[model samples]
Target: MTQPIRVLIVDDEPLARARLKELLSEESDMAVIGECRDGNEAIDAIGRQRPDLVLLDVQMPEPDGFGVLRAVSREYQPAVIFVTAHRDFAVQAFEANALDYLLKPFDQERFRLSLSRVRERRRTGATELDAELVERLESLSSRLTPASERYATRLVAKVGWRMRFLRVEDIDYLEAEGNYVCVHQGKQSFLTRETMNAVEEKLDPRDFVRIHRSLIVRLDRVEEVEPLAPGEMVLTLRDGTKLTSGRSYRARLQRALDLPS
Candidate 1:
């Protein structure tokens, strides 16, 4: 007979762990081998138990989910299903056939779907950690932060010799430059050290849109849109700052303007 999939549930909250446990109790092909409340315990449990699957919570006090992965990545590689309350900016990673992520407040249907993915992975006999999974884990490290559904109202940026808090509504657009993002405010620009994905996720999608690979614009600040060609265009902001939109994001720009595709 096929052995049941050994599972280890890890979460800081008792109810969160219990909720997963309760769900797992009903599944016939799964077995709960252990549980951990923090990253430290999780690391120890993972090493000692060597679970087939880990439903890991991303946020913890000292050692986070990323930390747990770093500690045991070399010697142990288990199929992981991350539990995150924060919205995913690592959509690319998830779409890359990496392990998986289970967002907070996941329903029974979603839970089963994640499990099915695991089953499919095991069925295919491709359980070893690969480059795609490594990329996914690295992506998570950059975007992982405390959970908040509220959009960012302001941003802290570094000026010549001081730091400044700039209001989000006042900013006209954002430009990506390697590791830093330039926040344009009327005539002044402030630079902040952050990834584009990290900054974009904090902004309200209704107010901002990624018009180009390296640019994000405030919707209301846009004054004009001119089509340069099929799947290409130019945008004029209220301040007369014209920026071109990328071909890949033309559809999104159109949707922001309520234009038919």
Candidate 2:
């Protein structure tokens, strides 16, 4: 008989933690060794229990899932499966070399698939996470923390064959194209792998605001907001480039401008 896969669950939400526990309970090969309500608790639990696998929430009150992982990596390391609601951070999760990511509201089939990978990694003795991967994961995790109170001052993007860093303030606007985001700055546009939602969250709200689901404009660059139709508005930039603002975001645009809604 094979040994049961000892698992630890870490999440801030009681309901989310309960749901995962309930699902894992159905698996005879998996056993819940411990549960943590926050990242700090998770670190202590990981140290004490030394579970084989950890189902961790990416967002938490403090020390977050990544912080907990970093703490574990330093000492009691375990295979990790990130549970997140945001799809935009998939690349960052992969860069961390996480066994798998289970998106929020995930179905049982997907959950089972992630567990399969974890089991395979364990059986093959193929898990070999390096220092470089950990550093990159930590950097990306810090950049994605919404409440960190630090705006992205610079962005790394590819230009032709070379990569360059662009100052955030120099960006005029951002447009979501398919899975990529086109960052406009001084008549030049750069394509980035970052989602518009992720980039928008990193920007200071006072300087950048989302005017449409696919568009974010720099407030300082806006010349005027002109009515394009009955409910739509067109934002004219100081450089005379026009970007359309969706009707649903009119109130948000007004609020950003400190104008009456």
Candidate 3:
């Protein structure tokens, strides 16, 4: 008989950790070796226990899931299965070369699929994993966490040597101003050193949409989207703010509205 695969479960949420442990216990071929409630504990447990597999949660207070991975010594690294609640990070997670990602509230079949992949890797020999791939995965994992969360919920900007935290939600729109990005909220405007593209990626897609190469607007704040002459379009916000839609983004705006055009 083959040796059972050893597994460790890591998550800050008690119920989530308990549910995963219960699910793994149901598998005859897998054994639950340990459980951890935070990334720091996960790092310590993984180094001490050296489980063959780890079911890791992406979001946790301090030293999050990615931090745990970073702390793992290359000689004792285990196959990782990332568990996340938000879909926004899926693309980035895959790009990190994660063995698999199981969205929260996963079913038995999905868990089985992830297990199968781990088994295949174990059978093939863990040494076969490319070193470059591991490094790239580490890099991508570090980048996967939203910048806003990494830095601060709000950003501090320097206006003539004065710095202040601008609440992210208060911003009406983001605009590219030369090398800097201008943030407008109510009657206040501030010039931030961050680029528009970087800011766009960090903002929640559901709340903010890029209307033009240089502009991103808050969706809930938008009051109306009007078709302009020929191929052009314009959007009006609840604050009576108006922004023009670029040709490239017209289809996206239409899809959001469920409009035929």
Backbone atom clashes (below 3 Å) for every candidate? 0, 0, 0
| RMSD value for candidate 2 | 14.1
> How well does candidate 3 score on lDDT at residue 120?
81
Whole-model alpha-carbon lDDT for candidate 1: 0.80
Candidate 1 residues 3-103, lDDT tens each? 99999999998999999999999889999999999876787788789998999987765356766675564556888888877766346436432377777
Residue 32 error, candidate 1, Å: 0.5
Candidate 2, residue 140: Cα displacement in angstroms equals 4.1
- lDDT head-to-head 1 vs 3, winner: 1
**Candidate 1, 22: how far from true, in Å?**
1.1
lDDT of every predicted structure (CA atoms): 0.80, 0.79, 0.75
Q: What TM-scores do the predictions have?
A: 0.52, 0.52, 0.51
Residue range 78-107, candidate 2, lDDT tens digits: 788888887765665452333667889899
- Span of 10 residues, lowest total lDDT, candidate 1: 89-98
Give stretches of model 1 more than 4 Å off: 89-93, 96-98, 133-261
| Candidate 3 lDDT tens digits, 1-261 | 999999999999999988898888888989999989876578768978989899989787645676566557766778888888866555554422337778888898988888888888888776333445445544565577665565324544558745566876887888999978898888889987667776775576766778889998877778887898766688888888889989888887777656677
Model 2: lDDT of residue 217? 92
The TM-score, computed over Cα atoms with residue i paired to residue i, of candidate 1 is: 0.52
Tell me the spans in candidate 2 whose CA falls farther than 4 Å from its real position.
Answer: 73-75, 91-98, 130-140, 147-261
Model 3 poorest ten-residue lDDT run: 89-98
| Most accurate candidate by lDDT | 1
